[model samples]
Target: MFAIAVRFDLHDTAAAERFDELVALTVPGIRAEEPGTLVYTPHQVRDEPLARLFYEVYRDEQAHAAHEARPATAAFLEQVRGLTRQLRVELLADLPS
Candidate 1:
């Protein structure tokens, strides 16, 4: 799997709310269109009112590329541009199972 975890620090609580809403809007398209996207989940960080987290898992590198190439993904990126203060993205690797 090609996976990633992202931590988004919103500019303020209000921005967090807007960001969450945008995430809700964006997810359905991902669910319906992204067959290779095994999981794409968003979380409100505990005790951090202005923080959001996302965990995304794709079938492979090509799947990740396809997801990023979508117009909806571009729109979502544009929508969230000013809402976040900072974002940290970590590319994840599978562990021995």
Candidate 2:
């Protein structure tokens, strides 16, 4: 398995709304529609209103790449571009189970 982790900071006031939108709308759609997506989880830090994290898992690198190429992902990115502040993405190798 491969993992894709992303961390970002959003505007404090928009944090809750953004997290809600992602969980209620974005995450479900991605998990159901993207075949390569094994898992998609988004989280927000309780103490830091602006902090957000995304933990995604896929079968492999090819699967991960395909997920990134999906139209829904593109649309989501476009929709959230303005809502996010600082973004950082990291590709990781999953440890043996």
Candidate topping lDDT: 1
* Per-residue lDDT of model 2, residues 1-97, tens digit only: 7898898778667665875575578788787787878888888777887788889898888998888788877887777777778889998875789
Deviation (Å) of 94 in candidate 2: 4.0
lDDT of 1: 0.92
Estimate the TM-score for candidate 2.
Answer: 0.83
lDDT of 1 by residue, 37-78 (tens): 999999988998998899999999899999999999999988
Superposing all C-alpha atoms, what RMSD in Å does each candidate have to the true structure? 0.9, 2.1
* C-alpha lDDT (0 to 100) for residue 85 of candidate 1: 82
**Residue 66 Cα positional deviation in candidate 1, in Å, after optimal superposition:** 0.5
Local accuracy by lDDT, each model: 0.92, 0.79
TM per candidate: 0.95, 0.83
RMSD of 2: 2.1
Which 10 residues in a row give candidate 2 its minimum summed lDDT? 14-23
Give every collision pair in model 1: none
Candidate 1's C-alpha runs over 4 A off are none
